[model samples]
Target: MADTYPWQDELWRQLAGREQHAHAYLLHGPAGIGKRAFAERLLALLLCRSPQNLEACGKCKACLLLAAGTHPDAFALEPEEADKAIKVDQVRDLVGFVTQTAQLSGRKLVLVEPVEAMNLNAANALLKSLEEPAGNTVLLLISHQPSRLLPTVKSRCVQLACPVPDEAVGLRWLAQALPGLSDEERGELLALAAGSPLSAARLQEQGVREQRALVVEGVKKLLKQQQGPSQLAEGWNAIPLLLLFNWFCEWAHLVLRYQLSKDEQGLGAADMRKVVQYLADKSEQARLLALQDWLLEQRQKVLAKGNLNRVLLLEALLVKWASLPGQG
Candidate 1:
């Protein structure tokens, strides 16, 4: 069985120890919060041949099978590719799996992660399976954005919310999880992740910190007439489109915050603070607000549809960003 995060220990005990568990569970939470790992641990506890203290006995046949990812009675479903939707055929296969008997004699388990990735057709296909309460089967649906799921699908299952930990707790966990990080780097990553420790660790591992530094510097150079919008956009072509937009949105919010309160606390990532402050001082307050709205709108459009021309959209935003200083 995979070990769960410290914050998940209480919830794990509650769900694992319960004899009358729900047939379907909707575990909803922010991304990178370890909900999938928690669900896996619970699934293992359910399938263990000889459970020990409401947890899995790792030496059991069931545990060994699950560890090997060859468990006959268990199925894991998710998007076949990154940024793709889960198709109706996948749910149809799940429906077929649900109607069958458990081969392990203990119970059958199905794990669906990021369930919101399922399209309308796929979600409708899953309703019947969720409605049928089987005696020896459990369905675990993990969602980062539960609001995107159909209400009918959500209403059928028991909902378990996993919340972001407090700043101190998140930073403490990050400190141990990423031992090489300096205190400043740890704090910046935690803030950027909005107090999700696992997300902060992933950001560091993915070099988002370095990318953000480059982006911030690019913004400064754009305002100072040292770089052109097309040049900056081309240089930023390697950064994920949504991620770049999100950072732009965050920086814009900080500019607005500084305009409103003249406080430094509104700034984000420590490395970007100087650049954000520079923009806040030189840019028009009203223009900053309008640009912030534009960034938010573009971010939404990009997220909803994947077919947009990334380079052109980014170039347009950078052009607008470059004009901010003179707009004042």
Candidate 2:
């Protein structure tokens, strides 16, 4: 993974200087960003008995083992089900890894992807190990929601806030990752992606790609036509609210950019220019900004409630959007 997406020079340098790194490290960022991949690079570094440089020496036997996912010194724990949780039992399992001596006899890196999945009990269980970890054992926790972590756990780790890359950088990188995508498809994929190349790759898969295109297409159609809001509301039954909120936020950004810059060469620029041009002369520009705020708040609300009725929430959002003065 590091081979494809090399660390920025600053990040690599920071990692290199940390001879006595924290026992627990937090890699937090927006969902679908490359936290897991970055964590893997760090894991490879920690486990590498001998490295050629700051990066994992790809030729080393340890690197080969890490790539094969059978590195005895490395352990990764993720949620059992999608968006469910890491239970207490999962943390206890880490206890097992920590108590045992490193199979590699050098260093061990335990990666907990989406550490926010840990329920209260699970977090507490891990806290014990973090407080008194075995020598040479390091805990690397990746999360989309940093605030969800317990304050105690938060204080223990050396935190890395992974900033989302610029949209152009992310899109260009992703366009180069996939081999057979068309220009339109690549641009659309970047538009739908959440600034995460990992997520962007997943969006390239046939089913996911089609769904995202449809979602964006739906938004375009509705926002472009009078009473379009009503049409948008019609499809809310099958859409997830969390996803809808995200889509709306992205759309607003596109519209705002397009309107402000009048650029049509790319996905966001073109779309945003169209929306901005349409509404810039209107008295309701302020209302549109308000709508953007509402969408952002809605996204936060949906994420906060793990059990929200996503479909209903989307429909309600559409209704509100349609009722707005600027909606054509």
Candidate 3:
């Protein structure tokens, strides 16, 4: 069974309590907020031969089949490789599946995760199935970045915006999810994950805190002239490029914010507060703004999965960052 989150209780009630289900639903939210799990739970309920209290009956034949990944009336479409586009051919296959009669004579269901992974051609192909709904077929489309989706595709489905839990709620859940970590540690993780609790848990598992500490130390050293950009860039080879970019982008934002507001409380995480303040005091706003612009441009390339020379990119970013402190 898909794990039901505490934060999703209201959303589940609203969705499951519907008298007539829509032919398609677009569940859009930030990544790691359990939208996929919510869709899975809904799919199970829709497939269950006998549901109790707006939930799937665990003992039912349909539930058993789904648990075993052998559901004849259900299909899940995703990229064959992680972070790759869902090919047009794959959508074509799904279109064929959409037209077929369900073996169980029940509602046919299809789940597509991160729907923005489909490029223009693939998305266009999916429109065929969306336009002509076959008998008792329901499609669940999940997207982390709905802005990338075609307007026509967005128009065809019932759009449900998933919620991001507040800090207190997230911390409460993190307490259970990561009992081994101290409250402060979990809080830092949550902050690092940008308030996405599941993402915080995932970052903990991925050793993101450790990587962040290393990067933080390196940044301090770079500013102090103790470490060169090339050395630090090569040393950080194990860390993910996107993660690095995100942290730098965030730090740049913090520096700018502090420079403008002089709000010490807005210095962000404790580990980098001093560094952020130092940069804010010493760096010219114009230089910081230009650096942020460059960071955003490069971040886009990172997101698009362009063929980037990671070491070179990191070196470039560090060189620019290292130059920030003495600019004023």
Candidate 4:
């Protein structure tokens, strides 16, 4: 059975208690907020021969088959490789599945995660199934970035906005999810994950805190001329490019915010507060804005999985960062 989160209780109630389910549902939210799990739970409940109190009965035949990954009436469509686009041929196969009669003579469920992974052709192919869904079928589409989805695709389904838990709720959940870590450590992890509890737990598992500490120390040394940009860039070869870009992007935002508001509280995480403040004080707003623009452009390339020279990119980023304190 798919495990639901405490923050999803209300949304689950609203969804599971419905008398008539939608033919297709678009569950949209930020990543790592349990939207996929929620969809899985709903799929199980819909396919179960017997459900109790708006939940799936694990003992049922359908539930057993689903648990074993042998359910004939359920289809999951995703990219073959991580971070790759869902091909048009894959969507074509799904269209064929959608038109078939359910083997169990019950409802069929189709789950597509991060629907934005489908490019224009694939998305257009999916529209065929969405337009003419056959028999008792429910399509659950999960999207972390719905703004990238086509307007026509967005219009065909019941759009459901998934909930993002507040900081206090996230921290409480993190306490249970990461008991080995102290409260302060968990708090820092949660902040690093941008307030998503599941993401925070994932970051902890990935040693993100340790990586962050290394990067912070490197940034401080770079500013003080103790470490050169090329050396720091090469030393961070093990860290993910996207993760590095995300942290730098965040720091740039914080610096600009502090420069404008002079709000010390807005300097972001404790590890980089002083660095952000120093940059804010010494860097010109125009230079910072230009750097932000460059970062955003490169970040888009990173997201698109462009063929980038990672070492060169990191070196360029660090060189630009090292120049932030002085006049442009």
Candidate 5:
């Protein structure tokens, strides 16, 4: 994959310019920042027979093999299913691969993406390969949440941190990626993505703005006692649990900001200003803080794969929110 975002130029140069590369590199960054794409480019460049200007020559045999997903010198390990753990058996297969000699004359490359998904056994199983890698072999691990990885695993690789790009750079890139979007829409998407251009583009593609509008509308009805918590929760079953909780968490924080600073700017969402103001005026500050804390806890639980009833959880949360005005 070519450098999809211009902000990655400096990191790409640093990786490409290195003459003596590490045996293993851990690319750690927030989600949707193109860490995997960067790793893929590095893999192709390492395996290319005739690289030019620190880039792989696309016509080379190795490049063609990589493009076709049949490269003899390359291996990629990922979860068997999305949002699932990388099993120990998968890592065991990688251990076997690393022991063998490279079929190609160049470097052998292994890529394990979102390495945090590895369970204890899977992580421990890969330790031996990392400890004593084969000659001319390179391992690249991409992790969105490095804090969750084993300390032993982290110590075995050179750490590379990818930062979120500047806001101006992110907006400019977003405009180019989504030329059809209005400036306001692009800004909203950027804010929603927390300034990650690639993520902002994805949010736009997923129509998160439209979904958020519906959610906000539902919230308004609930707050007015015109809608039941259970009914609203049932209607919102189509939205992902984590996403819905995250959105509510954001809204709660915005309400808190409005209460504290009386500054509407912290809301970030232009469309939600009126509701935010109303909530700030009607809700007790202490209770809002408690709800915010609870929402954060729930969001983290959902992300950690907690076993909870989503519909009931949502219903309970909405019930609390609907009672906020009365409590104050």
Candidate 6:
């Protein structure tokens, strides 16, 4: 298709000025912040045989090949399966491609989305190519968890944090992609999106939107109840850890907004005021931060081979959240 990059003018300008750009670039950021799009656009810029000023000339042979997904010099690698790590064989496959001449005799674009998904052997296997890459073959390494990548992998090239777009930008973009949504629907979607147009777009799908709303409503209900944390935790233990992360942050955002506005906009109608207020008065922001770390630790623990009682973990979180006020 046409090459129209919206949010990355300066990076293009910088790349244009460089006489010898680095071969590897690590694009790291939170999910759906347009890192993938940035990588794709940068790939086009690198492969474009001809460009008008800083933008890729979409009509060129290289651009057309990219559009058609037939660019022999370009490749993309991600985890071959969900929850299955990338093994050494996968990384080793890149060796021949990295060593060989580019199909266009110009630039080869090798993009690895979530380079952190690579196991140790796979990561080390890819090291030689990063150390002695073929002439002008760019490796755009994209990772949500870049810290998992070896320091050697990170040290070799540019690392850029692609932040989320502004709400208005995301809203406008999402509106065009997600038609038939009311202004209210769009607004809620924008809040749920957390400045991510991609996420807002995904929320347009019927089942997903309904599911998100259900989860939010469920969490709201959970937060308002009178039972002890342990008892209250029993009813809803099946929600994904990430979903818990999402809803808790949303609830906290609502409370913070309520604190700021003292209006309907900030109010959590689910009557979570006492619990949230209790935490706000007693807990440091670090305690709030610890929620994510604790959740992740549990996720990895479960992922690696451990069975955690879901209700108990949720109870522990609530009790920790409850008791945070007195910590030194």
Best by lDDT: 3
| Residue 291 C-alpha lDDT in model 6 | 60
Please list the C-alpha lDDT of all candidates, in the order they appear.
Answer: 0.85, 0.71, 0.93, 0.92, 0.86, 0.69
**Candidate 2 worst ten-residue window by lDDT:** 266-275
* Candidate 6 per-residue lDDT over residues 213-291, each given as its tens digit: 5554554444445446765566555445555555665556554554456565455533455655555555566656676
Candidate 1 C-alpha lDDT tens digits along 163-267: 667888888898899999898889989877877888899999889888888987888778778888888889987788988988889888887788778887767
The TM-score of candidate 3 is 0.97
* Pairs in steric clash, model 2: 226-328, 254-272, 255-272, 258-272, 258-273, 259-272, 259-273, 259-276
Q: Give the per-residue Cα lDDT of candidate 3 at 221.
A: 91
Ranked candidates (lDDT, high to low): 3, 4, 5, 1, 2, 6
Model 3: how far residue 243 lies from native, Å: 0.7
Per residue, candidate 3 scores C-alpha lDDT tens digits across 189-253 of 98998889999999999999999999999999999899998999999999999999999999999
Q: For candidate 2, write residues 1-328 as lDDT tens digits.
A: 4643533446657875577888888988876667777778778887886765676776678888888888898888988887677889988998899888887747788999888888889999998778878868999999888988899998988888876777777767776787687767666676567557667777676356655556656755665554454456566545555666776677666556555666665335343445445544442556667778888877876765556665556666765555454543
lDDT at 41, model 2:
79
Q: Identify the superior model by TM-score, candidate 1 or candidate 2.
A: 1
| Of 1 and 4, the candidate ranking higher by TM-score | 4
Cα RMSD of all models vs. native, in order, equals 2.0, 4.3, 1.4, 1.3, 2.0, 5.1
Off by over 4 Å in 6: 2-5, 16-19, 206-209, 220-240, 249-275, 278-293, 299-328
Model 4 C-alpha RMSD vs. true structure (Å) is 1.3
Question: Which portions of model 4 miss their true places by more than 4 Å?
Answer: none
